[model samples]
Each structure stands twice: as structure tokens, then as C-alpha cells.
Target: MKPFDYLSPGDPAEAVRSVARNPAAVFLGGGTNLVDHLKLGIVAPDLVVHVADLLPATVEDLDGGGLRIGAGVSNSALAADPRVRERFPVLSQALLSGASGQLRNMATTGGNPLQRTRCAYFQDVTTPCNKREPGSGCSALGGWTRHHAILGASEHCVAVHPSDLAVALAALDARVRVLGPDGERTVPFTDLHRLPADTPERDTVLEHGDLVTAIDLPALPPARRSAYRKVRDRASYAFALVSVAAAVEVRGGVITDARVAFGGAAHVPWRARRAERVLRGAPATEESYRAAADAELADARPLEGLDGGNAFKIPLLRRTLAATLRELVGEDAR
Candidate 1:
């Protein structure tokens, strides 16, 4: 790995100030993903600002029925929290479905949302990638792109955002609490990530000296069943090929409300707004589920016959959403 200066700030303000002083500095949490990229020569930050001391290690419930998950809270801790498991099962499931037990134990909530893509071309410095190096062109565009994006992709880049927890957060309408040089601010989780329109190099909307301090999950109503389902090449330790995080409320045999977000199929955690619109006030039937799924994938543009692998994501995604909806509704009825 390249040589880099290291600093462990005493607090969030110090950390942000340190990062601001050094423009080429990156915050280090678990170092699971960032360290790997540094060794791969994909990222060459001159300094490493450690934030382990700047944040708390556990989450606390606020008085107003919201959760204040510390930035340094580990995935295992967050998933094992009784309040989270009961109130936000989708978030817990999404966290557990990602990485492995060891990695999860080491991974933190703040870092999990900022985890970079696993695109082969982006990791290999030998290959040209717009995300790794802007204006250099993307090798994955014509290379092994079976695992690339199907939506919100630009000609400059087609890499997918690789975060299962972020997808669930997006669906839950969670808010990201950040501390920067200016002070504190809360950004919606959906707005945290950006699509690869013209600048694929920027992964998030975070400013140069911003630090994620905590994540606030608002309380969801009772009788609303939620779950996360991921399809991958293996049962575990593999990234998703197609994943869906959904929550639906069924009353009087009709859909009262629904929130859905998709991963592994787009440049960002894709909110199924179109599907949600179609399902609201509609009957909770197989036909309605299929129609809602179809509406979501209608504009998906999948890459075909890349690396001798046919892209069947459009239909597969539709089916996955349908199955998840059915499973959630069925479980709620019991």
C-alpha cells in the first residue's frame, strides 16, 4: 500500500478540521473496504483520519420514538439491538445479509453506507474506469458487465452501488446525521447517494470534510410487515445480483402503504416509486403485485449478452419484487 499519514481525532470537530486541513485525507473506520482499495492502488489518499474515537459505539433510543445509532456502531451490534430487530427488521436483515459475521462485527454503520462498489474494473488500476479515474473511460462498459447496473447508468459509467443496508435505509426514509466543517446537518438517506450521470467519480453527496455522526430511523407504524430478500451466486459471503427491501401495509384486503428499494440493479439504491404509486389503494392480489413489479422495471435498460452471460435482470427483478410482496403480505395475515 502507499504511504499515508494517520491521525485519530479526539472528537468529531477535530476530525472534520483535520480532514479539512488535509484535502487528501479519508476517514478510516473498520478499514475493511478502504484499506483494500488502498492496497489495490485504486485510492491513494495521503492521510488516514481515524474516527473510532470521535463517535460512540452503541445506539440509544431518543425520547420521541426515533433511534440514534452512533456512527461507530458495529453491524452486529446494530442488528442485535432488540429495538432495531423488532421495529426495523428490514434494516437488521439487510445488515445481516451483507458480508459475514467477522466482517459484520468489524463494519460500522457509518462506513457501511459509504462502502464502495465491488466492480472488477474499478478495483484494477490496470483497467480504465471512470469511477476510479474520471475521463479515463470505463472498462466495465464493454468488459464483464453482468453484475453492472441496469438503471440510472450513464455512458461514462455503469457500476452498481454495493450496499444492502443503504437500500433498506432508503426504503425506510432514514436520515443521515453528519458533522462537517460548517456544523451538523441531516440528509435523507435517499439523497446520500448519487447517480452516475456525468461524474461517476463522486460516490456520495458528502462534502470534503464531512463525517457521518449518526443515523436516525423514524418509528414505523404497527402491522406493517417488512423484509429484505437478496439473490446472489451463493447463499452467503457473496454480493447480491438482485435484492429488494420492502415494507407493506395491508388493510381490508387492500394495500394501504408500501415502500420499496432495489439493490444490485442500479447505480444507486433505487426507490420503487413507480411500483409504490401503482400499489397504493390497490387490492393486494397476485395480479396487482405483478403489475406493480412490471411498472417498476418498465424503464430498466439491461446490458445484453455481455461476457457470454445474458442479462435477465428485468424479468428477474420483477419476479423478486412480486415474491417479496407476497411473502410480506402472507406473513402479516398470519
Candidate 2:
């Protein structure tokens, strides 16, 4: 890693100011993702501002029955929290399915969503990657496209976001509390990450010195039946090929409410608004679930085959969503 100046700010405001003043300064949470970038030469920040100590580390109940998860709270702690497990089981399951026990212990809730794509080209400094170095051209567009984006991807970039927690958060209608140079503000979790438009370098809407203070999960009664399903190449320490985070509430054999978010399919956690719309007011059955999946996947534009392309992800995601919804309705998903 390159030599860089380090500062442990006394307060959140000071930390924000320190990073805001310097364009090449970055906030360090648990350093799980940032540290890898440093070693791989993907990022060479002039200054590393430590904010884990300054930010809140505990999970607290909100006034409206929701939960405010601290930015510094580790993934393991959040997943193991009784309240989170009881109410928002999808969030807990997503967290546990990511990384491993040791990495989860060091990964924070704030940093998890901020982690960039696992695209091999992005990590290799030698390769031409628009996301790593804008205007350099994307190497993944025609090479090893099996893991690239199928939706919300432009010609400049086709990489997908790699955050299981963010997918769950997007499905649950969670909000992000940020402390930046402009002061504090809250943003919807779905809007936190951005699609790879012309500005593929910018992964999120957050500006410089914007520190994610906490993630607020609104009280979702239907989330009790929520679940997260990740399909990967391996059983452990692998990114998802197609993942689904879904919540469905059934009343009198009819779906009253629903939320669905897809990972490993787009530049951001894809909130399946169309699927949710199709699910609500529909009967809680496999056919309804498949129809909802089809409605959401109608926009999927898979990349042409390079070396065993990602066209399979389309049907895989459809079936995964159907299976997830079926499981939520207490039916045999097989």
C-alpha cells in the first residue's frame, strides 16, 4: 500500500470537513474494501480519515417502530441482533450470506453498501476500465461477460454492484442517513447507488466527504415473511450470480403487499417495482409469482455471448424470484 497521511477525527463533522477539503482524501470505516483497493493500486488516496470511532456503533429503535442502524455497527452484530432477526430477517440473512465470519466481523453496515463492483477488470489497474478510470473504456463489455450487468448498463460500463445487504435494504425501503459538507440529510437507500450512465466513474450519488452515518429501516410488517436467496458459483466467499430479496404479505390467500430487489443484475440494487406491483392484490400462488417475475424481467437486456454469456441469469433470476415468493407464502418452492 502507498504511504498516506492518516487522521482519526474527534467528531463526525470534523471528519466530513477533513475529507471535503481534500479531493483525494477518503473516509475509512472498517477498511475491508478500501484496504483491498489500496493494495491493488485501484485507489491512491492522499489521506485516510478514520471515522469508525466517531460514528455510532449501536443499533437503536426509532420513534416509528423502525430501526436506526449505526454506521459503525459491524455486519455480524447487525445480523445477530434479536430485533433485526425477528423483524427484518431478510437483512440479517443477506448479511450472513456475504463474505465470511471474519470479514463480517470487520465489515461495517455503512461500508457494506459503499463497496464497489468485484469486476476483475476494475480491480486490475492494468486493464482499461471505465469505472476504475473513466474514459479508459470498459474491458468487461465483450470479455468474461458472464458476471456483467444485464440491466441499467450503458455501453461504457456493464459491471454490477456487489452488495447483498444493499439489495435487502432496497427491498425493505430503507433510508440512508449521511453527514456531508452540506450538513446532514437522509436519502432513500434505492437512490444511494447510481446506474452506470455516461459517468460510470461515479458509483453513487453521494458527494465528497459524504459519510454514511446510519441506515434507517422503516417498520415493515410484511418483512416478517421476507427472505434472501443468493445463487453463487460456490457455497462461501463468492459473489452472487443472481440474488433475490423479497417480502410478501398474504391475507385471506391474497397478496396484500410486496417488495422485491435483485442483486448481480444491474449497476445498483434493482428494486423490482413492476414485480411488486404485479404481486400486490394478486393471489399468493406460484403462477402469480412467475407473472411478477416476468413483469420485472421484461426490461432485462442480456449481453451477447462472449464466453458462455449471462443469458442464463435472466431465467435464473425469474425462477429465483418465484421460488423466493413461494417460500414466503409457505409453499413448496421445489
Candidate 3:
């Protein structure tokens, strides 16, 4: 690892100031992802600004029905919170489904959103990766792409965002609060991540000196039910092959409202707006669910090769969606 200076700022202001002073500096929370990259020689920072002590260490309820999750809050603590378990079960489930218990204990809420892609090409320094080094080219394009994206992919990159919790947050319409050189600002969780267009290197919309302060989750109606389902190669300790985070409200035997987001399918937490449009006012039935799922995957462009293996994703995602909706309505009846 390269030698670097370190600064442990006491507060948000100090942390921001420290980063602003040095353009190459990066914030350190749990060091789960950043430290790994540093050891791999992917990132060579001149300074490290520690922000673990700058924010609250737990989740708090805001004045309104919303929640304020401090940036320093650990994943284990957030998943175990009673309020989260009762109100936002999807978020809790997503968090618990990610990484192992030891890694979750070391991971922080602020660092989770900022984690990098797990693309093989990006991690291997010898291979070409547009994300790690822009204009160098992407090896995964014509190389092995079994775990690559099928939606929202471009010629430059086909990497998938690896956050199950982010998919749930996108479906919930959460907002991320940040403190930067220009003061505080709020960005929609969906907008925080950017697509891999021409510039695949830029991961998020956050400015150079900005620091994530907290994540604000808006309150949903009591009747609405939500859940997150992850499908991976193995039962555990594996990244999601495809994951769905869904919230549904049913009334009069029809869908009143629906929010759906998918992970392991796109460059970001993909909000299934096409599926939501199809589900609204539609009858709650297997036929309707199939229609919605078809609509969502209409524009999907699957990777080449492995024809039979890749085709199963469509039916699997549809079944997952149907099961989630059924569970939601079933819980509502109780």
C-alpha cells in the first residue's frame, strides 16, 4: 500500500474542510471497501479523512414520520432496530442478506452507498476497465459476462450495482443528505447513482468534497407492505444474481399503488417504473403479475452466450415478484 497522511476529524464541518483542502483525499468510515482497493493498488490517495466520529452512531426517528439514519451507523445495528424491523422490513432484510455478520458489523451506512462495483475486470489491475481507468477500454464487454448487467448497460461498461439495501431504498423513495463545501443538500436516493454512459468512471452525483451525512427514509402508509428478495448462485455469502424490492397496496381486489426496484440487473438500483405503471389499477392476479413483469423486461438486453442459463432470469424474476405481492396482500389482511 502507498504511504498517505491521515486526519481524524471531530465533526462534519472539520471533515468537509479537510477533504476540501486536499482534492485527492477520501473519507474513511469502516474501511471495508476502500481498504481493499488500496491494497490492490486501484486507488492511491494522498490523504485519508476519517469521518467515523463525525456523525451519530445510531438510527433516529425524525420529527415527521420519517427516519434519520446517521452515516456512522453500523449495518448490524440498523438491521436489528425494532423500528426498522416493524416499519421498513425491506431495508432490514436487504442489509441482513448482504455480506457476513462480521463484515456487516464493520460496514457503515455512509460507506455502503459509496461502495464500488465487484466487476472482475475492475478488480484485476492487468485487465482493461473503463471504470477503474477511463478510456482504457472494458474487458467484460466481449469477455465473460455471466454476472454482468442486462438492463441499463452501455458499450463502455456492463457492470451491475452490488447493493441490495440500495434497491430497497430506491423503492422506498429515500433521500440522502450530504454536507459539502457549499453546505448541506438533499439528493433523492435514485438520483444519487448515475448510469454508465460515456463516462463510466463517475459512480455517483456527489461532488468531490461532499460527505454523506444521513439517509432519510420517508414514511409509507400503514396499509402498504414491503419486502426484499435476493437470488444468488449460493444460499449465502454470494452477491445477488437478481434481487427485487417491492411494496404494494391492494384494495377492492385491485392494486392501488406499487413500487418496485431491481438489483443485480443494471448499473444502479433500477426502479421498475414500467412494472409499477402496469400494476396500478390492475387486478391482483397471476396474469396481471406476469404482464407487469413482462413489461419491465421488455427493453432488457441480455448478455450474449449462455442462452438457456440467461433465459431463466425472466421467469425467476416474475415468480419472485408474484410471491412478494402475495405476501404483501396476505400480511395486510392480518
Measured by TM-score, the strongest candidate is 2
Better of 1 and 2 by lDDT: 2
Which residues of candidate 1, in runs, are more than 4 Å off? 222-224, 331-334
Clashing pairs in 1: none
Give lDDT tens digits, candidate 3, residues 42-81: 9999999888877778788976567899999999999999
Task: Give the clashing residue pairs of candidate 2, or none.
Answer: none
Query: How close is every model to the real structure, measured as TM-score?
Result: 0.97, 0.98, 0.95
lDDT for each candidate structure: 0.88, 0.93, 0.87
After aligning candidate 2 to the native by TM-score, how far in Å is the CA of 265 from where it should be? 0.3
Q: Lowest-lDDT window of 10 residues in candidate 1?
A: 304-313
Q: How many pairs in model 2 have backbone atoms within 3 A of each other, for residues 3 or more apart or on separate chains, i.e. clashes?
A: 0
Q: Which of the predicted structures, 1 or 3, would earn the higher lDDT when compared with the native? A: 1
Output the TM-score of candidate 3: 0.95
The candidate 2 region of ten consecutive residues with least summed lDDT is: 325-334
lDDT, residue 77, model 2: 100
Stronger candidate by TM-score (1 vs 3): 1
Off by over 4 Å in 2: 331-334
